[model samples]
Target: MQTNYFYRIYLLLVIFVNAGATVDSNEQSNVGVKVFGPGWDNPQLIFPSRYFFVQHFSDKRVVRVEIEGKVGENVAANRKDCRIWTQVFNETNFDFDMIIVRYKLMSDRCSNGVIIKLFDANNELLMKKETSTAIYAEECVCHNLRWNELMNCDQNSEIYNQLFADLRTFNNSKFNFENSLEEMKRRYAPYTKSYSFCHYAIVNNEIYRKCYGEYVGFAQFMDDMLISLASKTRLPNTQLIVNLGDWPLSDTRRGSIAMPVFSWCGSDETFDIVLPTYEITESVLNMQGRVSLDILSIFGRQNGLPFNKKTSKLFWRGRDSNRLRLKLVDLSKKHPKLIDAALTNFFFFRDEIEKYGPSVSYTSFTDFFNYKYQINVDGTVAAYRMPMLMAGTSLLLKPVSKYYEHFYHLLRKNVHYILVDQELDELLPILRHLIRGKQYSAKKDELPASDEEQAAIVHNMRKFVLKYLLPSHIYCYYHKAIVEYSSLLKDGEIKVSKEMQLVYTAKSKKCNCNKNDANKDEL
Candidate 1:
């Protein structure tokens, strides 16, 4: 009884330090489902074994940094135009080196600059530095490079030459970029609102957006993602969400959205880290720059196979855009026993048949989950279907990929998926061993290392994904990201900024349910 009393006191202390947040419920707000009787956040359910892991492990899936001091912090302070809050700012903590203060700029307004001051034990200002912001053209870096490559642009091509150009502009220009979705598009670039929806926080110095990266056009899909989050979230102290997708990776510089994410992709001087799109897994099909697509739903419209049972053969289907898909088709012709690869006509529009031809019948995404193995190859950019592919029953077989999306760090080679390397020479042999039950030398084979290790790889991977890869977990993580970002400000209020990503007063607006009418199920 006495220990319980002490524990309650400690819990109260932690909550009080949270500025003004109140813990009204054990479960996080609108997480759809809960496994641990109102107490389990998404990270806890997805990573039940990883207790020592810091808060918000879902957002840190693709990016993990090791720092000496405390890596994650929650802060609350007051500043010039806004109340500064560091809800969940991440920084490297070195013991003796020059303390470098790095964090994301989360605000409801366009911050001209930030002033950091270092004080000694006596509280005297030992050092102070003023920092400014950097602006870029609406496109993410990866989109431009890939776009130029497809157009067959030589060095003289506008996009090719401008690929690495100094497109960085400063706030010194004093551009009025903070306008509503329609207003910004009409005045500047027609695509401004789509690319800048999550571009910046300050819209007319009133609305505050959540965050932004390469494809600000993802704002709509992000809105739907947030809606899903809202349906299931039940936590209290929830800030009004207003996630317009109009921010940058950081204000100092711009980089590529090549794989929606990657390791060490930050530019020099500005240490802002860019995040990938969540649309990869949910099939949101629209594009602002790359030749690929943006999807609205997390999965497809069919009932998928359960994990315990699936066809033994590997299954893959898509348009022929690169050597990866072409090779898979060729190999399938040679070895029908292992792979079921084929080309599907992917005419985006019916009029295209005049220039192209009859479209090949594309397989339903729901069907892929029924097979024991699914091929994940790069098309236009990183394969956006990876999240769904891995979540399905099929064990993923991808080439050794240099490109990556947000949650790549959560996966392990030969465990979550098999890697077909550059030459891809061993693709057939590996397929034979796994699907046909043919044995290969332990040292020569990549997966199921030895004969004795037949089920270990699959079992381990299945367990890891089953725990962490749920839409509920994604929603829970999303809510936590906003909460952490909101914590940086005093009282986590949005009185100073414009609109938030998931606006707390969202009901007043007409919500468009991402038209995935075919997909009846919710994540």
Candidate 2:
């Protein structure tokens, strides 16, 4: 009885001490632990992780951080993938309240922790925090909070350079955000032009959109993507002018600011920013109620035949968007054994239905991998389905075209895909060479890639898809491009125009930190 009484008294004393203790304000905020790579077998083992928390005050003060780290010297010397940077703000620092992370590369060894130093708006050191770098392996995998694949880290940087090349070239002249927007409105005004463009503003983590014409769910999908991004990290206040049409927008004669588009061509005097098509984004992520092509899903959920098991003949089935597609159908009809090309629907060539129709039955995207060769041709601008085709096990035969997507430049000829002539004059000869292993002369006499070479190309293409074309990478690319565009802005706060309808706002939602604990501690 005496021992029990003492134990009860001790327990009360411990509780009283903890209640009376002054807790740090930062500690009060629930900075959730983020795991980067695959979960460890041992529960006790710490994997690549980042502990993130933010405390938002009524005043709306901000601080941006750039978490930089390096791998071994040997790795750093030979490769551009040596260092990893979370988000890079210029040396000239201003007040930033939120943390935004972008993916780079690192080593597998976690022994050397990353060095973290906080700096104020004036570039003065405010605080220094050291954390283990072990959690940031080179093969570090993350579903969100940025993502990196097993491939070399430099690919991300290279793609970024290509995507923003036009922006950098145009940056020579100081950019006026308000004036450029007005110029875009005038240039593509609904009354003046047949096509319409949409305006979007991300102000203080909220998305606001105004479409001049029917977007056909483009604006909604984009809004969903932005919402997903903002839920993870706070974004800078900026505005975007997006072209909703199939073709790209250009003002080459007048030198207007580049507008973001789904695709572009190499031959055009175009300086437009190429963004991932909503179709591709929807295939990778959720598109709400819309019919998802869900092509990329073949990698996991869908059933697709293996490369060797697939038929040797080339296969293609799509709407008749270009004359080349119609020619392809004719060629397939002539050589039914070697090719199986058909128009699923005749829109552009409805008059020629007698020649190309009746339309063939719809083939599931997953069944695209049932053949050894898949032909990818341009539809409208660039074929948005290229990524989906590449993700499959079959070899992608891409005819040369002026049109290109954001990642089109990264695809190597005879490496990632087989490059055919623009006119496809030698397609039969090339196909015969690949199928029968017999050389045939054409416009330019070239031998078809060997069977081994074909396999290697498919392997390379799939690797590229896993490394760079995942939904996470798509989101990362969008966020990074927006940040770069925001940097070029020379104006103050962008306000919603009278025409734009209010779409979304994060102001209604509270900061994703432990508010109750933080407030209690503050009191």
User: How well does candidate 1 match the true structure in TM-score terms?
Assistant: 0.44
- Kindly report which residue pairs in candidate 2 clash with one another: 48-135, 62-96, 62-97, 63-96, 63-97, 110-134, 113-133
Which residues of candidate 2, in runs, are more than 4 Å off? 1-155, 191-193, 253-267, 287-296, 301-306, 442-449, 507-523
* Candidate 1 local distance difference test against the native: 0.37
lDDT of 2 by residue, 106-131 (tens): 43323333445445456654434444
lDDT of each: 0.37, 0.57
Off by over 4 Å in 1: 1-197, 200-217, 226-276, 280-311, 321-323, 347-359, 437-446, 449-456, 480-523
lDDT of 1 at 86: 19
True-structure lDDT of candidate 2 = 0.57
User: How many residue pairs clash in all the candidates, one count each?
Assistant: 60, 7
Residue 168 lDDT in candidate 2: 68
Candidate 2, residue 366: how far the Cα is off, in Å: 1.3
Task: Residues 1-523, candidate 1: write the lDDT tens digits.
Answer: 4224323333332231121111232432222111111111111111111111112211112122221111112222223222222111122110000111212223322123334333333455433333233111111011111222221123222211111121222112322222222333332234543434343232121223454334554455554444333322222232232223323223222322111111112232332222334454243212122323222121222133333345677888887555566667777777787888877754333454443333358776766756667878876446656766654445677776545544555677776667777556778777777765676554355566432243334444444433443333333434444433333323332233443442323233232222211212212
